[model samples]
Target: MTIAPQRVVTLHYVLNDEQGAVLDDSRARSAPLEYLHGHDNIMAGLERALEGRQEGAELTVTLAPGDAYGLRNEALVQEVSRAAFPMADLTPGMRFQTPGDDGPQIVTILDVHGETVRIDTNHPLAGRTLHYRLEVLSVREANRAELVKGHPLSADVAASQVEDRKVP
Candidate 1:
């Protein structure tokens, strides 16, 4: 099957920065990434580039920051009182996940002062361009469970969903 909406695709990718620095490589791990197409499991630009592609297809794509992790927003930087995280030594580069209205928001510590700690809520890759070398390993129609979950469902979970279903 071709890589299209509702299809599960397995692909190896080598991610690099604008300067050609290797950022992430799935090939080194010997495990290709598998995801349901059209889901937000990956950057939009990369997914769009693979639509309608077939197995063994290889391509390299460059993505602007906006199409990738997005531009960094200075407004996301804020200073909070030290009392918020009592007994813990907050240091730079430390990340904290706080429950937000929608989901957990990851905020990274940038600086620590006596009574206040400064944090940046932008993604670590924000404001950086993304370069990707991708090769499609395989593509197949996603199972009903995977399509419903917006991701790959484990075999156990798929079995449970099957048992819970009541056909009319």
Candidate 2:
């Protein structure tokens, strides 16, 4: 069966930036990453690419900045008082979560200027093309537990789902 919305998918992926530097890779881990498609568990572009693909399929996709994290907005970068982050040492490249109009947002420190800290609210991968080498390991209907969790069902969760539906 093809991977579609609400289907549980397991895949190993290697993500690289424009320069070909590895940003993240699931192959280095013990298990392939699993998630429900069209649930925002992964990037929209990647999910769209996975649509209609079958299990054990391997493919490479390149996502433009807009399709990925989107282009970096200069307006999102601002300088705030250093005192705003009391716990952090506050250095360039350090990331911190701050409250924004939308909600909590993670910002990376671009520079430190005495009492002021320049933070960029854009995602680290923003404004960059992303290349992904993906191998789909499995595809199956998402169990109730997986649907409820908005992710793939764990072994325990899968068992619990079965038990929950048993005649009592």
Candidate 3:
């Protein structure tokens, strides 16, 4: 059957950035990504590209920043006193999560000075165009449990509806 709402789709994909750097290759992990279609389990660009596709179908698609991780918001960048983070060795690229007005948010360390730390709350891929080479591995009706969970049944990718949002 074609990939449609409530269907579980398994796909092997190679993800790249505008500079042709490999971002993710499912083949290397030997675990294809699986998600429930129309359940907001992945990026819209990927869902649209896989719609109506069948097993073994291969295609390539490019996603604009908006369709992928979305444009970076300047407000997400904040400079706080170094006292804000007291745990562990602080360095660039360190990520931490904290409770926020809209739930938990991840803050990535951008730079650090003697008294101030610069952090970005935006997703790591925000504002970057994404290139995907997709290989449809399988498609089938999702089981009742999977449909209720709003994701696939695979243990490798077990995720709740809230956790599966706008992944590119």
The regions of model 2 sitting more than 4 angstroms off are 98-104, 161-168
**Which tens-of-lDDT digit does each residue in 1-168 have in candidate 1?**
688989888999999998999999998998889888898878889999999899999999999999998899999899988888865777799887888776777889999999998989888889999899999999988888888789977668878888889686
Candidate 3 local lDDT, residue 27: 97
lDDT for model 1, please. Answer: 0.89
- lDDT per prediction? 0.89, 0.89, 0.89
Clashing pairs in 1: none
- Global Cα lDDT for candidate 3: 0.89
Instruction: Return the TM-score for candidate 1, rounded to 2 decimals.
Output: 0.88
When summed lDDT is taken over every stretch of 10 residues in candidate 1, the lowest stretch is 96-105
Clashing pairs in 2: none
TM-scores, each model vs. reference: 0.88, 0.88, 0.85
Give the per-residue lDDT digits (tens) of candidate 3, residues 1-168.
Answer: 789998999999999999999999999999899889999889989999899999899999999999998999999999999988887579999998889987677899999988889999998899999999999999999876687778887654444533665476
Q: For candidate 3, what is the TM-score?
A: 0.85
Off by over 4 Å in 1: 163-168
What residue pairs clash in candidate 3, if any at all?
none
Error of 3 at 50 (Å): 0.7
Model 3 root mean square deviation, Cα atoms: 7.1
